[model samples]
Target: MDTEAVNNARHGLRLLLVTLLLTSIGFFIYYVYRQALPKPLPGIPCDEVAAKKVLGSLPSMFSHWKQHGVVMPWLTGHNLKHNPPLVQFFGAPFAQPTVILSDFQESQDILLRRGKECDRADRTLQSFEGMIPHHHLAMRTNGPRFKGNKELVRYLMSPKFLHEASAVQIYEKSLALIDLWSLKVKTSGGKPFPARQDIFDAALDMVSGAAFGFKDDLSITKRQLNHFLSNGVKFKEHENGSVDFHGFLFFGYIVAGHETTSSSLSWALKFIADHQTEQDKLRQALWEAFPDAAAEKRVPNVKITTTHVPYLDGIIDECMRLETSQTKITVGSWSVDDMHLFKPERWLKTGDSGELVYDS
Candidate 1:
């Protein structure tokens, strides 16, 4: 009786062990498969050659997209156009996943609506961190540090402060710029100079003062900032077990603040020059508004307020709309989200009406 009972119990124990082992094996296999599967690189070409070409083409693409919005057809071919237009590249190996975003609705969802569920895409933050430490205020979410920084910025950029700062900084700088441009004109006997330089000089001066202090001599600071922003620089270690979070704020301001604005102003001038009738109409509007030529000559002596030229303000707004300075903002994340480019029109949610919600 004892032998039979022991044998029966042993058989039962073996069966139970076999079942547990099989379950464990199944779970292990599932885990391994999940780990091995590639995360969706939204907006990235599935084809290797096309992805390579995309990385190769970014510098020119970044500039051209600002001038004339480009739809990345290769992305569509790869079934990668589901998200917004984007430009994805970093100083890393090609194995890195691409950056992507959806149209404004998605941006609103991610940035405003479902924002708590989202964070700035990881790889994009990493690239930026490598370039600009702690300067990524927008990417930091609503942390206390960011809160303090924002408060500081708000106080500094408050109406009274901005009014005074722009008076001392932008107005003076604008006069300096015109004086410099006049010198160039006189020296060259009215030969056309690339207006981009003037625009850059003006914007760089303006925003630098706006962001930092009016006293911070951004023109001198920008060169050093550029050097700091070169590719592959180390940033602070990321909180993740990964080393991706090195920061790069020092130079981020230079590029993120100035270049985009400068480009907008440059394109605005170019658009105006190319369309001389529009320019004349605007100039006449300006002349009528200012009225007194004697008083207007004091433009150099006084700050150029909004009251001085209503048409110029309208033109600036129109130019900003027609010529987007930043064509694509990159985003990469750890959640294996799809990466895609963002287009401007989709920014206003026009895609839903066109039945290209995903494709656009």
Candidate 2:
């Protein structure tokens, strides 16, 4: 071929490649933008009229925010007052109805009893990509595929694994957290303050160590584990969402360890902060569990386990309970007489032998 003809061909190929690249970037940008924001599936049977009155639009997003204000209170304070338990609809001509499960048994039946009903809507299949390839447990439909994922999770979470991993990574991170918080608390003159990001970072470190081996650059674990563990830490539980990056777009949700471990840590800290007694108990438990926890020039060398400190376990349980509105969404108008109230002590009761009751 002639030199001019070859040059022209090269130019054309380069131009084509540039066009494809630009188009790809544009598409990806739009996809990510759309994912982070909740959009209305207009035809979904929600109450559009009331939504408009509250938010001034048909496609209103009744997102989770301060689970207390947006959901729990509304469920207990408003919806429960209705005979059939009220539900709200979103969007116009075609609206999506929000199904509030006020009855715990009914929710359990739909989510746990009726297996197929619990499967992720097929619409979610598209979200299986990146670090979580299609076969990832979280992305699978409920059945054999999910079972395989469960088995994998079971192995990863075997007591031997968690206990070993906790000894190597988790407790180390916990100690690092103590140092970070000590400085922060000192800086704030020991006043109540926000430690969400720090907690997220600590959780992220543990998650990264769990998923990927520990890095010499420790904070990278915090950065990547943020995908699996923590996201939107600044947002209240109801308004909460994932913290995945653009590359993790398709892997919408993650299992830092189990379900929402990283975010749960933040909630745990928030709960502890709210209850000084619980916080003090936790501190005392920690000191007891690791006498060298505050030792200078040496990280506490302790093989810690939750069993050693019952109060610490109770604090975690209380944190999870209060997060129901944040995570579970209460339709408690059915069973729980008072779902909005936070009372962690109910989980504790003296047994006939004078031992504290423990039930899963």
Candidate 3:
């Protein structure tokens, strides 16, 4: 090559290298500055492991479960010690802050009284977008749109509507589930088998029966998208491309209903399995409540009058109490009962003030 041409090429290469080096240095300095920036608020900092982002903390900011599935209640059990309404921060840089409300009255005022002042976060809605990308109850924060969506669901869930459209479906599905479980247990030779899938399948069947009348596929149709509650509840951006708004909402119920119930049942089963005496008590309560519905045999015609069954009620409540700890929110349990037994009578007791001191 000619001398001038070679010289020019070398100069260009040096310039490019210098540019890249300067850019790298600038990025590093910017990252350091962001890390040094003051947190969103002064609170008890946690999860120093989370990534730094404007959309920090992801799911933990909404509740207790972090990106790595760690429940952040390492800050728990300090209710009387720390005097909550304590603020705790999670994540890095643009950290998501959480307030732990240990007081009942304060919680009531914030959750029930001043609900309008506190709107749901956007990223939380966005998290559900993969299931219900378009507008649905989970995605809506506030305003008339959220109101209409909730009202429609509330009406559909009303006793009258449920009795007419859904009760029969639930009953039949449940009976069929009992049969399936009977066969499963028999095949297991009375050994413990994984019940998660069975429970999940049953949930899927029940929710599908109620929501879509047993239609399996939920691919979107234009007609479905034009429904009144069809809009996008975006978190950061609309990079999710396109989805039929109506089908999004409908399918969301199918997925979420199954997930929530199945997860709850799994947790309940674990707790119950650990407490065999309570499980026996529950079985006794069940048989007494429905003489026709047997475990090994086909359960015929369960009366659904379970509200009158005390032991069963207690077992269910206790299961939920333990299961909620998985959510990792720090809160106290206030009940007058022997904490050991799966006793339901503890739920019925009154405190010294002649009032029930129920704590969530």
- Best of the candidates, lDDT: 3
Which candidate should be chosen as best, given TM-score against the real structure? 3
Q: How do the predictions measure up, each by TM-score? A: 0.53, 0.59, 0.60
Comparing 1 with 2 on lDDT, the higher-scoring candidate is 2
- Per residue, candidate 1 scores C-alpha lDDT tens digits across 1-360 of 999999999999999999999999999987765544344366553434434442443454455566667645443422343332543432222345555443433454456456567766575566665555466444566565665554544544366866776557666566566655665566557887655555766787777665555453444233322332442232122121212322344345455757776787787777677767758867776566666753566453333453545456545644554453444333222122422321222222224455212111
After superposing candidate 2 on the true structure, give the runs of residues whose Cα lies further than 4 Å from its correct spot: 1-59, 62-86, 91-109, 129-131, 138-144, 220-259, 281-302, 325-341, 351-353
The alpha-carbon deviation from the true structure for residue 48 of candidate 3, after best TM-score superposition, in angstroms, is: 5.3
* lDDT of every model, 2 decimals: 0.52, 0.53, 0.56
Judged by whole-model lDDT over C-alpha atoms, candidate 1 comes out at: 0.52
| lDDT of each residue in 1-109, candidate 3, tens digit only | 6999999999999999999999999999988777654354545533443334444554444454444344445345323345545544444454345556654435545
lDDT of each residue in 1-360, candidate 2, tens digit only? 699999999999999999999999999987765443334444433334444342323222344334333444544433444445434433233323344545444655566456565666443454444355534533655455666654555656578877776457777677666755565466567787666666656676666665555553554323333432344223222222344333231222234342376668777666776778767766776676666665553555645653455555556666766664344432222226755544554555667998655333
| Lowest lDDT 10-residue stretch of candidate 3 | 219-228
